[model samples]
Target: MKKAAIIGGGVIGGGWAARFLLNGWNVSVFDPDPEAERKIGEVLANARAALPALSDIPMPPEGELSFAQSLTEAVEGSDYIQESVSERLELKHRVFAQIQQSCPDTLIGSSTSGFKPSQLQEGAANPAMIFVAHPFNPVYLLPLAEVVPSAASDPEAIERAKEILREIGMFPLHVRKEIDAHIADRFLEAVWREALWLVKDGVATTEEIDEAIRMGFGLRWGQMGLFETYRVAGGEAGMKHFMAQFGPCLSWPWTKLMDVPEFNDELVDLIAGQSDAQSGHHTIRELERIRDGNLIGFLRALKERNWGAGKVLREHDERRRVAFHAAPASGAPLVMAEMQVLPGWIDYNGHMTESRYLFAASETSDAFLRLIGADMDYVAGGFSYYTAETHILHLGEAKLGHRLTGTLQVLAADDKRLHVFIRIQRGAEVVASVEQMLLHVDMQAGKTCPAASSVLDRLMPIAAAHAALPRPDGAGRAVGQRKS
Candidate 1:
């Protein structure tokens, strides 16, 4: 219902546009580049695919998106304005001036990774409204957004920006003080500098350096981060012990921290060639999709464990669950999950793996629980259902990139038990089916118990609606061929 403006439509700007647009904000974008629309459209396409794919909860219908001819046109009616033009301080100052003139009452944010908030607001008329709200690449997926405000920034404006960001499923890390590169980028620059030294000195190839990251600490960092990870490395002693053990190594000449390698053509060519050799088979778009899929899987995995960013994701999903409005009952099979088979769900046979079929069925169970008033609040109240038994039939094979739908049918239900059937399909073809028997349990008691009346009130209608449907052929079948 609210409107937001994005200035510039490069990678960062387009990403900001996607985040706002997908989160149900009317977005007005201004970029002088001729190809800005097409580029931003492509990013939106990816965002549409990747964002909703992360959860079964129905997202709010996307908001209207339009291109504005000028900065004033974009900013005049916007509630929030994000400036993501080039990194030059002068360019940022010019845009801030325009925004101040057009939308002085609105909260303005910048996507500058390194520039301090003070630098960005130096000459602006309404400097208190402008601050840094830097985000990572593929902004729609990664949740972290550093909210850095200047001394002159309005305290209320900073809090308002953080609130808006959280509403859009972002984790706003408040930077207590404005500094160059903010938080994450400073660490990234340190790593980049060291990596450049490694490549320039021939101590490691570009591919090898990347392998060192992706194959090692990168995975750990994805979940626990630097210090928390090192705490575990300390074994029994934790952070203090680890710090004591590794502190002396800081003085060692293991890294060339004081200087940067010259960026001559030879070094550039060497690094570029190695990078090409490492990943040239796939186009950048292909790589991005792969990266997005991997991130989704990683986040989902962490969500399962309730660790790190996954914990953040779980909190967001809880909010989404509360906001989601299930479709009205129509005696039709309820759509439980609609998603493409992520690359990680495939096996060596190049098709969706058997385990993933079960995963889809599990998702259906979750959706059904939500429908029956057994959502996060219900579960948190110490009552829930647990699967007692499952029977699955592999009807057909589903491959990677296949768009799959899981539809649920409540076969039978009582106060404490539910027998349900789920059909997993690729378009029109039934790829898999699952039959599940679940029992209600009081979590504290750890024993079978009747579910509360509130849950049964919602379940009976679905059971009644599904009572007349023809049974699945494999329903209740044992693992054997029938005799004539």
Candidate 2:
């Protein structure tokens, strides 16, 4: 039940708030900006749907939020402190000074992209307590954070920061050496420099460059990094061949890296002006929504491939699995419990394919077994029931997220065999039904076995309850039904 205090409610801070709160960590936010609260609130509204929907793992109830009166009020007794104010050194140093006085031992981090931890800690009484935990734009979704521990900082600070990052589903990389722009942002800087050159020289409009990126390598870059893209270009020869073939291009005049672009108002206005022209169709908020949606889609597809960023997602999913408590099965006969359907369960045709019905029906059967004493642990003791065969009759199509419940009945059961009739319910109507024949097998001899004495005791009640319930709709007629 550790609490996290956020001192700035800007983009990064708002995302941090969403992440912590979603992971069941109490969050206290303090933002003096007149519009910070409103902006963060809008971000949280999108985050509420996006974050939980990101995983199949049943997340715990999100932690409550408290809008603090002041910075001190937010940090009091907070286990972790995140300072995401403006990127100016003076402003960050000021925040650090207050954080040092208020919570010395608590891990204080700056969400600055370029500033080193040492720079932020400059004017502080206890600068060693502060570090840099630079996160991406949508911190709530993307799970990568760069933890930069200053040379003046304690050795344990990086470890502590990493532990906190892990809890919020972020992979924390502790940079051994500090640099102006750390890791991911370096690539961004390179891209930005080239993009500016394109605009300043009038070779391509801002929208044209954006189109070139979005339609070209930007599409590939979503799932694969730059190195991987080049590796593919090298074909079967790999990086060595790629380097030999294309490394000479660095000397060519392809890029405008010879001269640095000064941060002059005219150039800024030109680029900003074109950007505004290109984006005049939509507001900043709408563009942000579009970007968030793209990020979600990109990251999710990456997770499927289990690539660079997706690997972190896979681990986070594993941790979420360990932390999540699955809903217990309802033992009441013929009751449809959890009928949730994931996107993967549906076919490209937008309906629950026949094979998935078997899988879901099987899961529903598992639920019934769990309710009784014939649970997973019980079956894992070299005595699991094998589904000998299944006969399914799919009456209606089941789309993604369509509530499909199973009303199961022990049509017949004895020591060696189990005959189950499961009706798939969506609201009041029965959408599908299945008859599953399972055999209780002893793995030692690969032969059927009588139910264990302990299992028998639990089975009697379940069988009795299921027997008492009326047969479900779509029950197969005994006369016309095949031997199965």
Best by TM-score: 1
- Residue-wise C-alpha lDDT for candidate 1, range 446-475, written one tens digit per residue: 998998998887888888988888876678
TM-score to native of every candidate shown: 0.84, 0.74
Off by over 4 Å in 2: 262-265, 325-484
lDDT of candidate 2 at residue 316, scale 0 to 100: 80
What is the lDDT of every predicted structure here? 0.86, 0.78
- Provide the lDDT at 240 for model 1: 95
- Show where candidate 1 strays beyond 4 Å: 325-336, 344-358, 375-383, 386-398, 405-449, 457-484
**Model 2 worst lDDT run, 10 consecutive residues:** 322-331
User: What is the TM-score of candidate 1?
Assistant: 0.84
lDDT of model 2 at residue 45?
A: 79
Which lDDT tens digits does candidate 2 get at residues 1-484? 7899998998899999999998889999999888877888988876765665455343556798988988889999899999888888888877777777778888898889998777777777877778889998888988878888878988887788898899788989888888877788988888888888888888888999999999999888866768999999998999999999999988888876556678799899999899889998898777776776667667767777778777787678667554322333224544423445556678889887778788768767775565454655776787777789877876677787575667678877787788888877776677788888888888777999887877666666667666766665545545355534
Ten contiguous residues with the weakest lDDT in model 1: 321-330
Report the C-alpha displacement of residue 256, candidate 2, in angstroms. Answer: 2.1
**Candidate 1: RMSD over Cα atoms?**
4.1
